[model samples]
Target chain A: MNEEKKISGIQFASLAFISRIACAFTGIPNLRTNLPTSDRISVFLIGLLLSLLLALPVLLFIEKENNRGLQNREKPCPSGIGRIILIFYAAFFVGAGILAVSRLGVFASGILLQKNNLHLFTAILIIAGAFCAERGLEPTARVSVLLSAAVLGGLLFTGLCDVGKMKLENLSQPFAGNIPIIVREAFFEACMNVELPVLMLLAPQIKIKKKTHLLLWLPLCFVCISAAFAVAAAVAGHYADLQVFPLHSLAVIAKTALFERIDDLLASLWVSCTVLKTGILLYTAYVAARTAVPACKKRCFFILTGALVFGGYLLLTANIQFFANVLQSAAVPVLFLFATVFIPLFTCLKNGRKEHKEVAKQ
Target chain B: MKILAIFLCFLLTFTGCSATVGTQLSNRLIIEAIGIDAQEDGFLVSVLALHTQQSNAANATETQDSIGQVFSAKGKSLSEAFAQIDLVSGLVPLYSQTRVLIFGKEIAENEPMQALDFFIRNYTLRESILLAVADAKASEIIETELEKNTLVSKNVQDILESGKNNGLTVAVELYQFVNRFLDETDAAYLPVIKTQENQSGKKEITHAGIALFAQKNLTAVIDKDAAKGLLWTAGLIDNDLLSIPFKGRTLSVAVKDCKSKIRLHKGDIPTFSAEIQFSCDLIEYNTDDTLLFNLQELEDVNRELQKQVQKITEEFIRTAIRENGCDCLSLLKKLRNGQPAYYAQIKDKQTDYLKDAVITVQISSEILKTGREVVKPN
Candidate 1:
C-alpha cells in the first residue's frame, strides 16, 4: 500500500469499533436460542471473551508477518490456491456487507419509517456505501474516527436521560438461564462481530506504533456492548422482550428537560454507523476481488462487488422467514471461524514451514 | 461529469421513492388523548384530537371549547374503530402526540390487556404515555367540557401529576403497567380519574384514587389514603402534606425527601419488611400556641406524624394484600430480586405465598425545618 493509503492504528480500531457497535444498536437479533434481556450482559461479556480467543490466530499472523496484509501474503502461496483463497475472502466480505445493509433496511422499515419503501431506502444506502468505498480506505477510516465520537456522545446523552428510570429489580442473576443455551447464544453473538475478519484483512494498511492499541479494542468493545444491553434491560424491563429493537424503544422514551424525543436524531446517527460499516466491507471486498483476478480493471471489480452485495441483500430479505432462520443458523459462525481463524493459522504454519525448508537448502 | 451523474441519480431515487408527505398539519387529526370503553358487542373508542383547522383567533374567542374535538367510533377492535374515525373525520389520526390513555371501569375490570394491546403494539404510540382508569365511562371524562381554554386531556394529565407529586396517587405509565402485568407475581395499578362538578357547577376531572389489578383483573379501587400508603411503600412519594391531630388542633407538616427499602427474609413462608425514612417541614397549624417552637413539642409532633403514617401504610398493606389478595406492594418482585432461589421454589404458587406472607412496616420522620416562624406568634 502507498503511504497515502496507510491509516493509523487508532483509525483502524475506530473502524472496527464502529462496525461492531452498529449491530449492537440494533439489539441482538433473532437467534435459535432466545436469551432473556436480563441475561444479555453476561452473554455479551462471554461472547467478547470468545471473540478475543478466536482473534488470536489473526493477531499471531500480524505478529509473524511483519505488517504484510492477508491479501499481500496471498501472492507468496501456491498459485491456484492463492487465487482461490482470495476469491473466498472476497465472497465473505460481500456476504458480510449484504447482512449489514439488509439489517439496516429492516430496522429502517420496521422502526423508523414504517410507511416508507424498504427497497428504495436500502438501495440508496447501498449506493452511498459504494460511493464511500470507492473513495478508498484512508478516507473511510478518517471518517470513522469522527463517527465514533458522535456515537459515544449520543449514547452518553441518552443514558444520562434514562438514568433515573433504571431499576435494580429489572436485572437478574447472570447465568440464571440454561447453561447450554447461554453458551450457544454467546457463540452466535461473537460470530456477528465480523469486524474481526475485517481487521485481519486490513492489518497491513494500519501503521502501528504499538500493538497495545490493537489489543485494547476487544475490552473496549465489550464494555460498550455490555453496558448498552444492561441499560436496555434495566430501563425497559420485560417490555424489552416485546420490542423488535429494545434500544430503539429506549430511545423513543428517553427524554430530557430540553428535548422531548430524540429517537429520530439518534436513529440517524446509528444508520450512519451502519453505512460506514457497509462501506468498509465493500472496500475490503473490492481489494480481495482485485487480488483474485489481477487482470480485471479496478473500477470493474468495485462496481461488480457493489452490484453483487446489493443482489445478495435482495435475495436474503426476499423471504423474511428464511432470512430469520439463516440468522439463527450455525452457518455464520462456521464461516466466521474459517475466514478469521482457520485461514490465518494455516497460512502462518505454511509460511513457517517454507522458511525452515529454505534455510536447510541454503 | 461524474458528480453531476451522481447528483442526478440521487435526485431521481429520492424524488421517485420518497415517503408520502402530502398530509398537512390540517389534514392530520393530532390525537391528544384516547378513551376506550367496553361495549356489548365491541368497544366505544373516543379520541380527543386537536382541531388544527381552527384559526388562532377563532380558537382564542372560543376558548370555552373547540380547542380539541372528540370523535367516537365503535367496532370489535381498536384498529377497526380507528378506521371508522378516519372515515368520519376524513383525516388521518396521528397518535405520536397522545398524552394519556384512559380505560373505562368495565374494560379495566374485565379485559384491560385486551383494550391496551393495540396501544402497546403500536409503533407510533409512546410507551411513557400516562395511563389511567375512569371512575365510570371513559368517554364521559374525555367528553367533559371545561371552561377557560382547558383541554380535557391536559386537565386529566395535570390532575394525575399533581396527585402523584402530593403522594395521593401513584402515576403509572404504559411501560410500567405492562411490566407489572407481565410479571405474574406483581400487580399493576393506574391512577383513577373521575368527573365531578366543581363548586362553580362546572364539570372537572379529579384524581379519585387508584385502581389495583391482580394480574389481568381489576381487583380493587384503593382510596386516596391507601394510595398514599402504596406510594410510601413503593418510594414513589416526593412531597405530601401530613395533618396530625395534636393537643386539640391540626398540625400540618410538608413531607419531602421520602425513601423506602423493602427487605425479604426467606423461611417456610417469606417475611417482608419495608423501612421508610422521610423529612418534613412544619408548614401550618390550626392553633396559635407559642410553645410550638419548643424542642419537646417538635419531638411530640414528629412522633405523632410517624404514628399516623405507619397506621395508614399498614392499613393499606392489609386491605390490599390480605383482604383483596393484591400484590400491589410488589413483595413478590422483592422476593425475586432479594432471594431468587426462594422465589423459584414458590414461583408456581406466588399468589398463595403472597397471601400467607408476613409484612412489617417501619416509618421514621425527622422535622428538618419549622419554616419562617421560628419564634411563633407573640
Candidate 2:
C-alpha cells in the first residue's frame, strides 16, 4: 500500500461532486433547450437538485472505504462484485463526458460566437481531452482543481458585474410547472451526477481519514448547485427560461468594465473543464479494463482514447436535432436511472451486507 | 515493430491534416444594417457591407474602407432578394454583425412578419437586435451616413442610445416585438424614425410617431399627444412636465419614477381597475395671490393632481384602444395569464373582451418639497 497517498476522503467526494454538478449545466440544457419564459427557474432548480442526488452515493461509498478493509485492494485479483461496480462507473462517467462536451460546443457556438462551427471545435476539444486522459488520474485531478477555480471565479465576476439587472420580483413567483416532471427529472439527474465515485475504485488504493469526506462533499455539492441557480436568476430574470443556456447568456449580459465580454472567458473555462472531465473518465475506463484483464493495460489506453476520439468526432459532426431527439426520448432516462438508482441499490445491498456480516463477527 | 510503425503512421496522418486545414476569411459579406421595403415586385432588400480590408483596425474607424458597399435586390422572398445582392456585390452575405432592422411604413402596414422570418430562423442572428419602422423608404435612412460616424449603417442604434424621452417613439427590441406577436391579446408598437438632411454636414434622425400592429399588421399610428398619455398610463413617464391645478393656483410638477398595476373585474360591466403610483417634487409655482399653508389645502392639491393624472390616462387608453381597437396595454394578455377562466369565457367574442375592460386609477404621491419657500405676508 502507498501510505504516502495524500488524497483525503473529502477530496474524493469533491472530485465526484464537482464532476457531476458540471453535468447539471450539460444534461439540463438538452431537456429544455428552448424553454419558454415562465419555466426558467423551475428548470434551473430541477437541474441543480437532480445533479446533487445523482452525486451523493459515490460520496457515501468513498466515505465507508476504510472501515470495510477496501483500501489497498487494487493490486490483487479484484472481486466479481467490485469489477461490476467499476464497469458501471466507467459507463456513467464516459456518458457524462460525451454529453458535457456536446453541450459546451452547442452553447459556445450558439451564444458566444453566434456561429455554426460545432463540428470543428467539439472534435478539437474531445481529442485534447482524450490525450490528457492517457496521462494519468493525479494530473487529471490537478486539472479538475484548476478548472473548478476558474468556473467559480467566472460565476462570481459575472454576478458582481450584473448587480443592477437582476430583479427579485421576477423570481418572487413560485415555480410553476408540472410537479411530476420536475420531481422525476430531479431524481433521475441525481443518478447522473453521483456516479463519479465509482471511478475512485480503480485508484481506491489511495486511502484517506474516514467520515470527514461526507461532510466536505455535501456542502460543496450544495454550494455549486445553488450558485448555478442564483446566477441563472440574476442574469436572465424573467427571460431565463426562454434562453438555451442561461449561464452562457448571463456571461454575455455581464458587460463589465475593462472587458468587452466575459462570455469568451466562460467558454475557455468550459473547454478546460470539459477536458479535465473527459480525461478523468477515459483514465477510469483504462483502469477498469486493466483491473478486469491485467495483461492489456498499455495497449488499452491507446485503444480507449482512439475509440472515444472517433466517437466524439461522429457525435459532434452529426446533425444536432438527431442527437437532441435521441437524448429526450428514452436513452437519457434509461442510462441515468441505471447508473444513479439501480447500480447504487445493487452495490449498497452487496457491499452493505458484507460490512454487516463482518461487523457481526466482531 | 510492424504494428508500431503502422500506429505511428496513423497518428501522424490524423494530426497532419488537422493543422493544415485553416479557416479562410469566408467570402461571406457581413451585413451591418438591413432595410426591408415593400416594392412593386415583392420586397426590396438593401444591405450595408464594409468594404474588404486586410487590417482589423479598419473596422473600428469610419474610413475602414473607401466606402461601405451598398447592395440592393428585389424578389418575392427576403432570402431570395438577399441572394441576388450576392450576385451584384460578389460577396457571400453574412448576418452575424447585423445590428438594426428597418421596416418601411408600407411593409409595416401590410405585413411585418413576412420580412421577419429570415432573421428568426438564422442561428447567427441575435434576438436582441433592435427593430425600427421608417416614415418613408427604409433604404433612404440606411444610406444616410453621419459625417463623423460614416460607417453608421444602423441609424436606430444611435437613436435608442441618445434620444430624449418622446411620447411618439416607443423603442422595442426584436424579442419584445416577437413576444407581442406570440401573445394573442397583445398588439405590437414599434418606434418610427424619419431622416432629415442637416446643413452642418452632420446626418440627423428624428423619432416620428409609433406604428401600431395588430394581428401582425399595422392598425393605426398614435400621434405624439396620445403617445405621451399612453406612456403615462404604461408608467414609463420620465422627466415630464405636468401642470397641476392646486386650489386657485397652478404648480409645475416634475414627475419621476412612475409605476402602475391593472386588475380586471368580471360581471355585467367588465371593469378594469388601474392603480398608478408616482413620485414628484414641486418644480415651480406661479400665481398672483399669496397662499396660506394648511393641511386641508395640501390634501386638496394632492386630490386635484390625482384627478388630472387619471383623466389623462383614461383619454389615452380611449384613443389607443377604444377608438383604434388595438390593445397595446395587453388587457387581453393580463386576463389570460392572471385569470385563465375569464380569458376562456371571453375568448370567442372580441366585444366581450374589449367592451368590458375598464380603467380605474389609484395614486399615492408624496410632495418632497413645495418649491423653495412659502410666501410670507409682505
| Best-performing candidate as measured by DockQ | 1
Local error of candidate 2 at residue B178 (angstroms): 1.8
In CAPRI terms, where does candidate 2 land?
Answer: incorrect
Model 1: residues >4 Å from true position, as ranges?
A1-4, A27-31, A74-78, A209-212, A296-299, B1-20, B55-65, B266-270, B375-378
Per-residue lDDT of model 1, residues B242-343, tens digit only: 999988988899998888888777776678898999999999887875535677778888899999989888878877887777887778877887787788
Q: Give the CA lDDT, 0 to 100, for residue B282 in model 1.
A: 92
In candidate 1, the residue pairs with backbone N, CA or C atoms under 3 Å apart (3 or more residues apart, or in different chains) clash, namely: none
Model 2: per-residue Cα lDDT over A66-173, one tens digit each: 333222344477677666655665565566666666666555555434434446555556666666566555555555666666677777787777775453323323
lDDT of 1 by residue, A69-106 (tens): 77787564427877788788888988988888777766
Worst 10 residues of 2 chain B by lDDT: B12-21
RMSD of each: 3.2, 6.8
Per-residue CA lDDT of candidate 2, range B35-99, in tens? Answer: 89999879998887766553244454544343466778899989899879989877666665677
